[model samples]
Target: MKKIKIIILFTILLLPKLVFASNATIAITGVNTAAVGNNIKMYVTLSSSAAIGSWELTLNYDSSFLKLIGSDADNGGTFMANKVAGASGINKKVYTFTFRTLKAGNTLLSIGSSSLYDFDTMGEMTVRTYNKNLKIMTQQEIEASYSKDNYLKSLSVDEFEINPVFNKDTLEYSVEVPENTKTINIKAVANDNRSTIDGLGEKEVVVGNNKLNIVVRAQNGSERIYILNVNVIDKNPIEIIIDNVTYHLVKYKEYLTIPSGFEETTIKMSDIDIPAFYNKKINYTLVGLKDEAGNIYLYKYEKNKYERFLELKLGNLKLTPLSIGNKVLNYEKETIDFDGKIDVYKIDKRFKLINAKNILNGEEGLYLLDIVDKTAVKYDLKDIYTLRKLNKIYLATTIIFLSTTALSIIIMLSFKRKPKIKDKEQKVKEKTKKELPKDEKVVKENKKNK
Candidate 1:
């Protein structure tokens, strides 16, 4: 009973320490499992009641079973734990652990603290097992699976439907699983003689079961020989529409056929006539027929006349005289009658009159006389005559006006006389001579008295 009491006391003392020590809970939210070469990320949250001085985490796992391909811990550090001092004021600590998978299979991982000599604490917590699987099937395995199932023979595509097809060039098949199925795995392959023009390939797709319309296009131009094998929980038929045409698509496979009554005709144009100066070429409307499966086959119309124009080279005619004295004259010189003679006068004063009857018979020219009446009507150059008459009148009026004005000016300048002013000495001398001549007798008397 005394020993039992001692054990109880010791347990009581350890309980408080265990409760006060930091406890951690780790969980993976996004992806729990990773493929052979893929990465796995987990969120680590540590909870504690008492302040942690410094702590370290040691990750324990089977290296042989799983290899750590890569990791992004605190600064690319190794998977070993180091001092993680608890944050001030906050009682919990959290960290993220990201790692890549090198090998496959389940790996038992444990994250715990080292043995504490000075302080009593909880060591570590053992989390759940992490199971990793292979990434995907190889191209050869996918091809073989597709061949065995005869998926190629049963494959068919619809318009506007998203479906996985085999890519011969890349040797890969991509498929999306429907939402209704819990899980789905798909494999595909293609084999055709025109593999050079078309591609050949195989692929594997794995997805969770869901009712979703999956879209798969053949990469590397391998749409011709597409074969696919689908293992789905729900075996409902899938519908796909290609090129706006509808088709009943099966989950596993179906054959695609060009609908019946679908005839395609092409009209080849051997020659086409178009106006050279036309701005735009004629656009021919294409006519064709299509089936419910949305296959477009084109037909063209027969070539017809595109344009037309008159076939004539029109030009302007300019006539010039080669010789002088090309007098197109007539008896009535004013009018050169149609039967007139075109007198060709030479520079030697001799004239040769050629009957212009031929040239003037149908030609047109200016006429100075009325040929029909045979009347002689003087043809006057109105402007020249008027100007000459005006000049003569103006000259006569100017001469008469100028002569009269000159005579009047000369008569006024010569006949208009002004009296000259006499000098004061001459007036005085004349007065003295008059007075002396009247006193001649007294002068003689006076001289006799002197």
Candidate 2:
């Protein structure tokens, strides 16, 4: 009994030394924290001093918290399959296991009863064991760490003072620089450290108004925009003449109204870039023209010529005639009692007027009559011609049919009654006998009786 106790004590002491002397180790490594519904990957690595013949291990994890999705085994450059037995001898190997986090809790992933065989002796080898602990977080916890502050704490420009002073609540500003200032430096800071800022740094400036936007995006994906209107001075301006009126290039584009389906663009005039709008469908570029009296309007640019885009409003009819060339007749504005405001023009001297499209509603054949009372009419040439021809045919047919009917009525009347000439002759004779004397009348009557 004493010898048995000693042998057991010696064995217990030798077991600790054998464990400590292990030259091979197996470990599991992955991210320590994850959110629910997130897929995470864990690596199982086996490291040994010498190459081993094979290895076997069973994975242990909480099924309720982590669901195994996929796995891949790698032995050096070669791939080891998931099956238990295979032609395998490796010094180093790694198994990648992917798991989808299902619940919010602390979970443990460990290896159970792992064994490695010696490559030369085909005997078992001792290896140190390792495990991984991960914390799965709820959505509320994830949201708590994110910031929703999208405001800018401060904003400034280099070598210039922001207009109206810089305030966190003020999102708009204006800055004026010299004529030669080609670029300006902008700096913006977010209210929260977790937020991100864009559109900060060197910005290109134009001769006139330059609109720069500084955007701040929070960690929660919220955003805010700050506008900086930078105006570079123009000492010498471009001037143009239109219809005996002097107009200048517009400096501020905010006063202009952009039309639909047109995008903002730029045009070069005298080597200077001018803000313009272009519509590809119409193939037209319109520039903002400012008059001497500070009135601004949109004018079409064509072959270095500029003309006011005419928008005529008469009664409820709005017309935007093609004003480029002879598409419209030369007219003077007249006040008609019926139309309130109308354009009186002579279409008789011009070619068949074409290219006038109604702006309000799509209609064809627009004309201005120079008659007693001037008015606008919508007509189709082909339809008008057909209608006129049909009207003439109807009128001639009615006239011929009525004349034949009247002649037939006269013939029937002659056949149904005595002749007007005989009746008139009899009446004349009777009158003459009556006028001669009562005795002559009696003698004439007796002769007739005999």
Candidate 3:
């Protein structure tokens, strides 16, 4: 009986190892390949190598390149059987893993037992190859296409279409072209106060391309170089007008209106004018005019005529007293009509009727009269009654406040007084006598009375 029990205990202990050894068998069922940005799925199967009882199985693998996303080992065990005995023998387990490919290289996925008791059933598999491909573009090709469409669509370089005058301040001028081009070299000639300014000559530019930023700048007193763009591919003569003046014209549409504050005085044009039949039909003529101030106006002629008008209005006006002396001046109120726009009335020294300091410093009776729309609005300039009452009340209140403050200070100083040492000792002696015995108190009281 003892031998049987020992054997049973030993067997029971080794039973798990035996069962695990029978079930621990690993195999690389599938191999897969994937791109760098792609993924792959792998399936693995584990079956019992021999007949075995209940046992636990733990799987280990290199999680670097592959991952055990899911598993189903319960279906291979007793849980799926109607009775425990029906599932006691060899069983099979299935495992599914998903792996993400990283970089362009090879990686190995290994599977093995988690512990010594799990038995020596280990294997490994490799993903054949992982790769990635990248595509890139050049900068010059991108810039070339961008330049063709941006500004070259409406350019023309022709002999008869160029305007002679060049704007120095704004550095803008119009030129005629026979054909529209993406880029151009322009040369400008002008006098610089009877002296030539060096480098005030020629410049090149790329037009209508986003990569090139156009800027116009004056190089000398009278001459300016236009660093401009011409991206339009069209051959139509583009009319380039700067500051409302037609520099060049392929076709004229309308005349520039006179500025808000000026009037039209004259009209100037180029020496050559197309015939009357061609003139009215083509609407292409250079016209010039002047204001009252002699400022020149240049534009393309399209419509019949032009005119000018004023644009601004005057703001509010105010009159204030600076001072009212002993003698006051009386004047009649008047209205002034202003044609310009008005903002607000200012009553500074510029619009003062008298010195205001004198009115504040002296005792003088004055009057104010405001004139608006030819009507007189009158007001008294002094408040004698209110001033006298205010002065009396202020004086009384000041005196009362000063006296109360002084009294409070005196009471605080007096209350801070300290009792003398002699008085304190006397208090102590009286208290000691009252607390003594009856005979001692009577003796002390008799001595005190004596």
Q: Give the backbone clash total of model 1.
A: 31
Query: Could you report the Cα RMSD, in angstroms, for every candidate shown?
Result: 32.2, 18.1, 25.6
Q: Per-residue lDDT of 1-450 in model 3, one digit per residue for the tens?
A: 999999999998887653212324544444444454445555554455443333333434444444444444344321111112453444454455555444444555444332212222322211122122221123343233231111111212233232434344433344533333323444433332233323222333222111112222223223323333333222332334455753332122122343222333333234333212112222223344332221333433456443211111112212222223333323322222222222223233223122211111232223222323311122343555577689899999999999999999999877665456668889999988878777786999899999
lDDT of each: 0.36, 0.73, 0.36
The runs of at least 3 residues in candidate 1 whose Cα sits more than 4 Å from the true structure, single-residue gaps closed, are 1-23, 27-54, 69-105, 114-280, 283-288, 295-450
- Candidate 1 lowest-lDDT run of ten: 306-315
Number of the candidate with higher lDDT, 1 or 2: 2
- Candidate 1 residue lDDT tens string, 203-303: 23222122222223333333333323333333333333445654322222111121122222233322322111111112222332222322322222224
Give all TM-scores, in the order shown. 0.25, 0.43, 0.18
Pairs in clash, predicted candidate 2: none
Candidate 2 residue-wise lDDT, 312-359, digit = tens: 444454454542242333533332332222233335543123334465
State which candidate has the highest TM-score: 2
TM-score of predicted model 2?
0.43
User: Could you tell me how far off, in angstroms, the CA of residue 441 lies in candidate 1 after the best superposition?
Assistant: 99
Global Cα lDDT for candidate 2: 0.73
